[model samples]
Target: MNARLQPFVLTIAAALLLLGALTYSARAADPEPAEAPRPALTVTVVQPQRMAIPMRIAANGNIAPWQEASVGTEANGLRLAEVRVNVGDSVKRGQVLATFAPETVLAEQAQIKASVAEAEAALAEAAANAQRARDLQTTGALSAQQINQYLTAERTAQARLEAQRAMARAQQLRLGQTRVVAPDNGIISARSATVGAVLPAGQELFRLIRQGRLEWRAEVPATDLGRVKPGQAVEVIGASGSRLAGKVRMVGPTVDVQTRNGLVYVDLASSDEARAGMFARGEIEIGSSQATTLPQSAVNLRDGFHYALRVGPDNKVSQLKLKVGRRLGDRIEVLDGLPADARVVASGGGFLGDGDLVRVVQAANAASAPTPAPAQAAAPAGR
Candidate 1:
């Protein structure tokens, strides 16, 4: 071997060793495989439950008197002398409400009585004359024409006496009419009669709420009128946020042509807050039926619609649009768009989006989880 050939062989061996070292270093610096992402959120879930949902019909209306009694004067051209009751006064049946001046009526009655007495005296005289006429006719001592005239006079006097008695009775009735009395037990709602004011016949003096009772005139849609029946329970929500209990009295026979609405008269239980002419809203419970219900926390409102977060077996959530019905406390009826067995996110759903991965925690587990201690300030360094 020549010396130049030996140097070349050693150089080739060194280059090969360096190439192997570089290859090992590159393999060692390669990064490890990345891990799959964990669940981004933890949430509690719930399932639909079957419950009895009450069927109710909603209505709006005004409060009014059950029956308004229009009290008016029957005596004509009588001056009211005294008024015993005013608006808002409670009255009993036959209670005196007002009194007219009785002087004129009494005087007229006295005059009729005197006339009646005079007629009675005249009738007695005529009866005596007729008896005499009859006696003389049998004896043939009086002519038939003269006897008939006496008899006719007697009959005329008798008729006049009866007429005077009838007039006297009429005058007595007029005297009684001077006093205005309550026709029925009620509360006075309005009054137009005043002392010293002369009123004519049939003039209204007071308006009374019969038996102090109030009613709610609910206007229900004509299509739903058939559902209302007598004696059904009603819950009325008043303008002041008070709830009143009532019962359905009757359904109107006809519906309004323009609004296609029928009226339902509901008798409200007596209450101080209930007043006539107040606008109110209410619901009538017709019946009940089974329904699939879910907690309100499980439902979401977005984009003018309701939604629920449905959890799949893969721990992925899908947003579901919901058709919901009547809502009770903390629970809502699921009318459509959801299966009875579906599991939905109970709460914290507002922070989630569709198709997001989630970790489910049961109610018991969530309740039992250890509460994190509030962070404490670090102690001053070796104070």
Candidate 2:
């Protein structure tokens, strides 16, 4: 029984020895476990460009009428019968904006006409008597004193008729004044007249923006006033995001003592979106200057500051804080923090961290770069 048990133990030992040998061989053939080296990001790099950037002076102010004309009732103490125009109405020169009670003026004019007619009739009779007296004097049938009295009467009647006509003319003028017309082509900005409301002479019925023109009066720093000049091109941006093209009409002759600010008057072209009393911001194009600029896409904003991802010789990215300036179109001025000869990631810097390894390529090649394939299991050691 002991010999049989020994044989079975020997067979089991042999099988275990063969199994251990195979395991050792498989372990020897396996590859080492380690991560493959790959770049953190494939990116396009760009160099700063020296370009001519337009120099502009920024300011803020209100949009207002270029010139305002007051439209008022010329005749006094007349009731506003009809208001033909309202606020925001576009009007032409001599266009009727309001009408007063013309009945009263017309009645006065009629009375004046009657007086003139009566005077004219009296003058005709007096003239005929004066002519007869003169003829009789020459014929020795009339006294000189009587003839002289007739001549004086004719002259007085003539003067009275002229006075009556002048009064009639004045009454007619009043009648015309009952209707208020626009003094110039404009848009009505304010309306004070109402139907049946009696207004006095020179009472404003409407306020018109002369020629429908508008302007931006910007307050600029007094220290920068010398940079502004008349006729310089300006671009005004309103609160509603409306852009208006304008030219500098004039700069204020004096600056405020307390605020140290001056006014720049910019005459803007008419636009439907622009209105009086709207606050706005604008830039005056003073001139152009050479500046180092970069594309906006290449810049990153983080923690309330701007940054650029600059690439090093070793292909590692160094996050650089940037001091940026004016922006025009797709380019932004780099005032500092970036060397002129350094290359930076064109875009996608937001996804990276400092000292990140990246693969740099040309823009044209980057667009056509193929996506990396997924890693696969290593081939079996023997295979």
lDDT of 2 at 58: 78
Candidate 2 residue-wise lDDT, 113-185, digit = tens: 9999999999999999999998898787888889999999999999999999999989989999988999999
Off by over 4 Å in 1: 1-45, 310-319, 351-383
How many angstroms is residue 129 displaced in model 1 relative to the true structure, after the best TM-score fit? 1.8
Best by TM-score: 2
- Clashing pairs counted in every model: 0, 0
Overall lDDT per candidate, in order of appearance: 0.87, 0.86
Model 2 TM:
0.80
Candidate 2, after superposition: displacement of residue 316 in Å?
A: 3.2
For candidate 2, the 10 contiguous residues with the lowest summed lDDT are 374-383
Global lDDT for candidate 1? 0.87
lDDT (tens digit, per residue) of candidate 1 on 1-383: 99979999999999999999999998889966899878869999988887666677889999999999999998999999999999999999999999999999999889988998998898899889889999999898899999998899899999999899999888888888888899999999999988899988999999999999999999999989999999998888899978898999999999999999999999999998888999998888887778777777888888778899999999999999988886765667788899877889998889999999999988974322232221211111111
Model 1 error, position 15 (Å): 27
